[model samples]
Target: MTTNPTLVLGGTGKTGRRVAHRLADLDVPVRLGSRAGTPPFDWTDPAGWDPVLAGVGAVYLTYQPDLAAPGGAEVVAAFARRAAAHDVRRIVLLSGRGEPEAEHAEAAVRAAGVPCTVLRASWFQQNFSESHLVDPVRAGVVALPVGDVPEPFVDADDIADVAVAALSGDGHAGQLYELTGPRALTFAEAVAGIAAATGRDVRFTTVTTEAYAARLAAEGVPNAVAGLLTYLFTEVLDGRNAHVADGVEQVLGRPARDFAGYAAATAVTGVWKP
Candidate 1:
């Protein structure tokens, strides 16, 4: 296989880590783009751009925080320009499904003239075991501000496989993949699923966005982060994305992993043990 280094930005993150591992397993030269990576890269630091972009042919772009966050377009545009100038051929962006700002960011990458593939993934199933929900689940109460919105939470494993194919070949350029699981479930339903999988009493509690934000603030989370979380739960999870998408099938020629599958597998890790 002819190859050049593929940089996996946010290599320590959910999908990025999986992407990096998949690429490595395929014998692709993978450069991890993180603050602690060799020749570290930072989204906010322009001077560090050259070191990371140098000699890298393709990039798996996972923005810090998210593309829906403020200034996401500008940063994506800037990095795309740098990547283009450095002869980077392919840019696969991990974007948000149904987010306007995320689409704008994808445009920024395309505008730079590099072949780009947008993986617009829905809520991740790993967010429970891998993110803030872990402690809550172990504590037996997973409280959140979301109501009956049913999200088709996609698995990072499927995302990584599609990303690996996109990064290694020419088949997926300029394609926007809406990556979601085959079934949608409300937060409460998801919690129940996890509870059943882990054999524990992990409950889900719904709260107002304002109250959730206030709780976050009381926990020492910065105001900006708190507001962003509130905006995400209140504005984005408003039932617009309560359906399944076939991007995974389109790209991988296989069905996407279901949330129940994710819950079953993650339960084996004992992350929810208390």
Candidate 2:
């Protein structure tokens, strides 16, 4: 295998980390682009960008927090400019489906004159095991503002697979992949799956957005995180992301992983236990 080093931005994060691992497994050289990596790359510090991009042929861009946050597009645009200046040839951006700001960031990458593939993804199934929802599930009750809205929560593994293919393989340039799971599930149903898989009495509680935010704040979650959660649950989870997409299969030539399978596998590890 040729050693075309790829820079994985947010390489320590949910999806980027997995992508980096997959690339490494295939004998591809990967440079982790995170504040903690050697020659650290901090999104808030533009000075850290050029060094990370140096000699990198392809980049997997996973913006921290989210690409939908305030000023995220500007930051992504600036990073793209720097990547181009550093002679980066390809960029695969991890984007959010249905987010206007994410679309703006995608446009910026496209304008950078490099080969770009946009993976516009839905919510991740790993949110329950690896993110904010983990503690709530461990506590036996997961509360949120979304009620009855279905979401095809894509697995992070599948996102990483698609990302690795786009970054390392051919025929993905100029493509926009809307990545989602094979099926959609409501929050209640999703929690029920977890309960069944883990043999734990986990419950899902629906509340108003304000109430959910207050609860999160009371739990010592930072204001920005709480606000972002509120926005995701109330605005993004309101039946807008209910349908499944074929981007995963389109990119990987295989069906995306199912959420129930993810829950079952994660349950065996006992990560949701208190």
Candidate 3:
């Protein structure tokens, strides 16, 4: 535990919230950085970041929407410079695997002169249980623009544990950890696992990008969000990240959780039932 509180940007988000909980469990103080948090930290509004950075010893940096969005590197670099100015001792950035923009953001953080660790993770297994896929899973059919490209979907819990270690311990600075599950699975295979765990009839189906976009528009999703989803499903899922990584074991000395475990655990929570 650093003497001062660790600031968790995107504190209410998937991995950020889990990291905050783990740090708190270890008796570390945490300041949440979100739109609803005190001294709200919004990526679009950097002028308000000083208060959030004050007296903070470290930061778990994650961008809203995504770090892969346009201007992401510039924004992250600017914030990193401010963090350096504030004398923040450490930074652990949540990044994405195989994303050029995410890598650029990592480079920016390294250039900021702060001791930092980068976690470049594959897709999260929690997407089915905690995000937009939840509804589709509940509805018993997950339609997407992706096909046979497999992704090594990592557990958010594993990522959280690694982030906590980097934040609270030493020997992690200047390291880039590529976090992934033990194996890769296509979206269909993942959904099949969910179906087996939940004893439900959830299925995955592929659709044309145009059809998916139309569905998003009909559901009232904003055009920007729809575009991001399309890009992720199409460009990012082009089999570029279909391999497993051992960063979880490298950092925490344990194997990363499998998607089956995630689905089984989440199934017990009754979230997959309609």
Candidate 4:
């Protein structure tokens, strides 16, 4: 049994927190691997890695911002090496689909010589409720550069469940799971669904990628983050991630959650209420 406390990097984020909670519920000791965690694991500080890795048997890695971001693969490789040096045997990485950089990061994690499971997830359903779009949804307008191209937005809960299973159970090592919702929906359709669920007049506005990037800059968002979004909206969303995957069902013997279900559930929480 992999009974020791598993370290959950990005533990305060949506999927990470859910994984930590699920692990704790199973009576597994759960360590939040963040700068705020005991021994203080900071990705920006290489010196902090050893303290959190000590005595850890498994790790759930959710890179900040994105695994496809600049220099992300190198950082992942370094951290995986440190974990292997500390004798940590299991690793579950939260990754993205249709991303070349994400693939590179995955390879780096495997090169650490530890048994690993990769969850290459689609766009998250929680982006509307828990991330940048919350304010826009609440304000009744979600403007972005994405349009027409459909995405099967996977629920964070499914990702977390799969991560928990991979972390605690056998037979998941060397697995690569592509997790997505059962169906794809365009951004406008998604916003309409949210509006139906929340009884709001939320509108989805499509803008040019350049205009979106300029808006982000005007709003004082970091250039790196803005660039990531621009890349996602303009380049990555071009029908590459349009299909659904059964990774959640394959891993957990259960179907992945759908986007409408997510919006309906989130609606009841008043998160989209103005």
TM-score of each: 0.98, 0.97, 0.98, 0.98
Per-residue lDDT of model 3, residues 1-274, tens digit only: 3579999998998999999999999999999999999888899898999999999999999987888888889999999999999999999999999888888889988999999999999999998988889999999999999999999999999999999999999899999999999999999999999999999898899999999999999999988888888988899999999989999999999899999999999999998889
- Candidate 2 lDDT over residue span 57-176, tens digit each: 899998878888888889999999998898888999999988888899899878988889999999999999999899999999998888898999999999999999988889989999
Deviation in Å, model 4, residue 87 alpha carbon: 0.5
Q: Rank the candidates by lDDT, best first.
A: 3, 4, 1, 2
Clashing pairs in 1: none
Question: Per-residue alpha-carbon lDDT of model 1 for 39-140, expressed as tens digits?
Answer: 998998999999999999899999978898899999989999999999998899999977888889989889999999999999889989898788889999
> Candidate 1: which stretches are off by over 4 Å?
none
Report the candidate with higher lDDT, 1 versus 3.
3
RMSD of 4: 0.9
Quantify all predictions' global Cα lDDT against the true fold: 0.91, 0.90, 0.93, 0.93
- Model 2 / residue 180 / CA error / Å: 0.7
Q: Candidate 4: misplaced stretches above 4 Å?
A: 1-3
lDDT of 3 at 114: 98
What's model 2's lDDT at 263?
Answer: 96
